[model samples]
Target chain A: MTQRWKLTIEYDGRPFVGWQRQDNGLSVQGCLEEAVRRFSGEAATVHAAGRTDAGVHALAMVASLDLEKQCRPDTVRDALNHHLRPHPVSVLSAEPMAEDFHARFSCRGRSYLYRIVNRRAPLALEAGRAWQVSVPLDAEAMQEAAQRLVGRHDFTSFRASLCQAKDPVKTLDRLDVERVGEEIRVTTAARSFLHHQVRNMVGTLKLVGEGKWAADAVTAALEARDRAKAGPTAPADGLYFTGAWY
Target chain B: MTQRWKLTIEYDGRPFVGWQRQDNGLSVQGCLEEAVRRFSGEAATVHAAGRTDAGVHALAMVASLDLEKQCRPDTVRDALNHHLRPHPVSVLSAEPMAEDFHARFSCRGRSYLYRIVNRRAPLALEAGRAWQVSVPLDAEAMQEAAQRLVGRHDFTSFRASLCQAKDPVKTLDRLDVERVGEEIRVTTAARSFLHHQVRNMVGTLKLVGEGKWAADAVTAALEARDRAKAGPTAPADGLYFTGAWY
Candidate 1:
């Protein structure tokens, strides 16, 4: 009997090419498939809810896979973990799911967090983990400016040129920007996102954080609906796919 | 003419041997001397309050170094930062100090913070940053037990066998243990500490956190004044020389 399992995975995406398998280099899918093959002799493809990009971290990326073996859920988890020890990948949890469940299609909403360390000194422990900006940032201004981007609208200005979305419209459910200590965090949620949409929005908000742009300017950029009007995309290192809702 | 400057330095101690100069490998002193040579063309020796070990970290380690060059304080800071760009060291602040201000001898008290992650899965991003424990721990119990070791004590039970201190007695001002989420942080303060004393105290507290030993057991172990009575020394990865007061 075929059994489907939903796995909540977490990975430091620095080493992988992305979430999807590619011929050029390693991917999260490749690591999952390799671990799965090591545990079960039969090879199976892994499907993920989010196809994150290179240098993008994940806290709870959801995935589903099928196995022919009738092992216990814990057995599969332990075996995969044992085999995956050599890699930086980890499977946080695994459970049996309905055969009809699709990791990518069934996900209702996804959340992403962008971190920025605002300080004069160079980062030590958080060198690659958080985006380090030497100049001080006004997080309050960024938060107010980000609110202008929170409703259903044509996000063509924020969408990447390489984004393959059918339409430019996206309903941004939440965009909360806050500062904690010396770090600024931007949490965003949406049913789905276009490629580089979050990064572009963050880049636009950087102008606000730096005092060059205001909340009204963000509205103007959205009304313009031109990619050239938007700020440059933020780096991928600070972006994390936090979770996905079913 | 001689000029002395006070330096607040931050470093990721993983790459260097320690906070002091040694013949074997790269040291924080060696890096600072190189940066000084690059700027003033004169070899400088830095005197830090704590001579930390390898793989340890520091947030605001205070140091004092004499410079023969008549450069401004900001120039020294910026030039050192410019030259130390290739290395994982940063000069947070540089100010002229009295000639008698020795970093080690003039220090009042030193503080250290140790971090442990209590979880089943191994660390990915925080691999070298925190100690991971598979077994669950009761941090409140550890905190309560930690109070038993506070104040002045011989601490011979917690001292390393190889410790070369003249006397085992020392005044421990504070030893606080607390938990934040899955992390248990232990902060210890003292006028001075014997070799591996903090790590030893934390190791013993782990027994209390695990329900293996009680709060009174810690007091008993300290009173016994026997090295065999205390727990093993914790790993060096999670240790940090947080700050030093002058």
Candidate 2:
């Protein structure tokens, strides 16, 4: 008997190509599939709620797989974690789910967090974990500017050139910017997002934070509806897939 | 003319053998000296406030060096940082100091932070950054037990066998334990510490956290004045040299 299982995972994206399987380099999906095969002796295909880009971390990535082995949820988690050793990945939890459950299709909303170290000194402990902006950032200005990107709209200006989404329209539920000590955090939630949407939006807001652009500039950029009109895309190091909500 | 410069540094200790120069592997001090030589063209010797063990990180470690080259503090910092490229070390600040100033001798107090991830899943993003304890830890118990070694006392039980301290008696200004979500942080401050003192104390306190030992056990361990009476030394991964006071 085969059972569908939901797995919540955490990974350090520094060592992975991306969440999707690719031939160029090691990927999170490839590692998960290999771990599944090593433990359960089953060739399983794991599906994730989001295909995170290279150098993008995940706090709780939702994934699903079907396994024919009869084992406890704890066993599956531990075994997968054991096989995934040496890789910067961990199976946080595994739960048996209904056969109809799907990781990507059943997900209703997704959330992400971007960390910026607002300091002149280069990063030491967080070298690869965060984006360090040398110039002082005004969180208030960025917060006000981020509001322009909220709500439903055609986000072609923020979309990646090679994005495969059929529609450029996306409903952004939340886009908040806040400061924590010397760090600035950008949090966003949405039903779905166009490729590079969050990063492009962050990059644009950063211009506001740095006092180079006004908050209203974001409104104009969104109205332009051209990818070239928007600010440059932020680096992937600062982006984290926080979670997926059903 | 030689100038004395005081420097504040931050480093990820994952790839370092320790803070001091070692023959076997890379060390933070060696790297800093090499960076100094590369930029200043001087064979300068760097002196640090503390000699941390292998895998111990630093948020703001104070060090000092003498150089014959005349340069601004900012130039010293930037040049050293540029020369230290690819290494997980950063010179946060540099200041021209009086001839009497010294990084180690002038230091009055030192503080440290030890992070424990109280979770079942193995760490992914924080693999070598924190200590992961699968079993739930009682922060309150640990805090209570920590008070036993607060005032001036002989810390032979917690001191490393190879400690070079002239005396085992010392005063602990603070030993605090607090929980934040799934993380437990232990903070301590003192004028100085014997080798492995903080880690040994944390190890013993962990036993109290796990309910394997009572708070009174800490009092007994301290009174025993024997290394074997204390818990095992905690791994160096979780320790961070927070700062050194002038």
Candidate 3:
């Protein structure tokens, strides 16, 4: 009998091309699938809650796969981790899932964290982990601007040119920005997202935080519903897929 | 007339070899000194509160140099940051110091923070920023055990063999181990420390937290004054020079 499994994987996105498999480079899913195949001798197809873009990281990314194996959950976790050691991918948890549990299709919500170090100095320990902005930012202004984007809207202005969303309309449940010391964090949650919507929004928010754009500019950008109207897309280095609800 | 200047510098230690200049690679001191020379057309010696090792990071690292240049503090900060940008170093603040001020010799205390991620998850964003421990740790027990090594002692058990401390008898003002979620933080404060002292103490405490060694074992190890008596030294990646007192 085939058993479905749910896995929570964590990875440093620097080494891998991205979460999806590509002919030219390595990917988190490809690593996990290969580990699964090596351990169970079955070619398993893994589905993830979010197919994170290249250079985007994750602390707790959910995935599901099916295999015809009698091994315990611990065995699966250990075997995958062993094989994945050569790669940056790590399997944090493994558990038997109901047949109906689907990693992508069943995921009800997703949350992401964007980190920015606000200081005159460049990042050291947080070099790749955060967006370092030497110029001072008004996080309160960013928060106020973020509140304007926390609702259902056609986010074409925030969508990437290559984003393959069936529709540009998405419901953003939350978009909150807060500052801690010299770091400003942008936390976002939504049931679903249009392609590059979060990053594009963050990029525009940066302009607001830097006092380059007023809060009303954000509302006008949304109303424009054109990608060219938004600010530059933020770098992928600071984006993190923190969790997904199933 | 020459003036003594105190510089509060910040740098990303990843690119440079270390705080001290060496023939093999770039150093933080070399970058700052080079910038001073470029600004004043004269070579300057830069002294830091601590000579950090390669790949080790610091925040609020204090340094001092003598300069005869006629410029405002903000001018020096901006000029150095501009020149040091090519070197990943930044001068956060610059001020006139007492003629007798010495960056290292005048420091009264130094504090360091060691981060340990007590989990099986592979680090993506925090890859080089923290040490990961797969084994479950009893943080409270570790905290209780860390106290055993507090106060003044020879600390030879935790001192590295390569350490150059003339005398192992140093007063430890505080040693604290606490848990913040999945991270176990070990904070140490002392007037000065032998090489690898903090890492060594943390390594020994891990044994107590893992149940491999008891709290009494740490006290015995200190009394033994034997390097082999304590646990292995923790990795340097988790260590951070948090602050220094002048």
Per-prediction DockQ comes to 0.52, 0.81, 0.47
What TM-score goes with each of the models? 0.95, 0.99, 0.92
Instruction: Give me the candidate number with maximum DockQ.
Output: 2
What would the per-residue lDDT of candidate 3 be over residues A1-246, giving only the tens digit for each residue?
998999998887877788998998999989998988788888999999999988889888999999898778988888889877678788889999999999999999999999988886555456667888877899999999998898899898999999887888989999999999988999999998887877899999999999999999999999998999999998888899999997
**Worst 10-residue stretch by lDDT in candidate 2 chain B?**
B36-45
Badly placed stretches (over 4 Å) of model 3 are B9-18, B23-27, B30-42, B68-91
Candidate 3 similarity to native, TM-score? 0.92
> Between prediction 2 and prediction 3, which has the larger lDDT?
2
lDDT of 2: 0.95
Model 2 residue A55 distance off true place after TM-score fit, in angstroms: 0.7
Clashing pairs in 1: none
Can you give the lDDT of residue B98 in candidate 2? 95
Q: Model 1 over residues B1-246: C-alpha lDDT tens digits?
A: 889999988888889888778999999888988898999998888899888888888888889999999988878888998898777888888999999999999999999999998977766666677788878999999999999988888989999898888999999999898889889999999988898998899899999989999999999999999999998888878898888887
Candidate 1 vs 2: which has more lDDT? 2
What do the candidate models score in CA lDDT, each in turn?
A: 0.88, 0.95, 0.87
Model 3: per-residue Cα lDDT over B137-166, one tens digit each: 999999999888878899899898988879
Of 1 and 3, the candidate ranking higher by DockQ: 1
Task: Looking at model 1, give its docking quality level.
Answer: medium
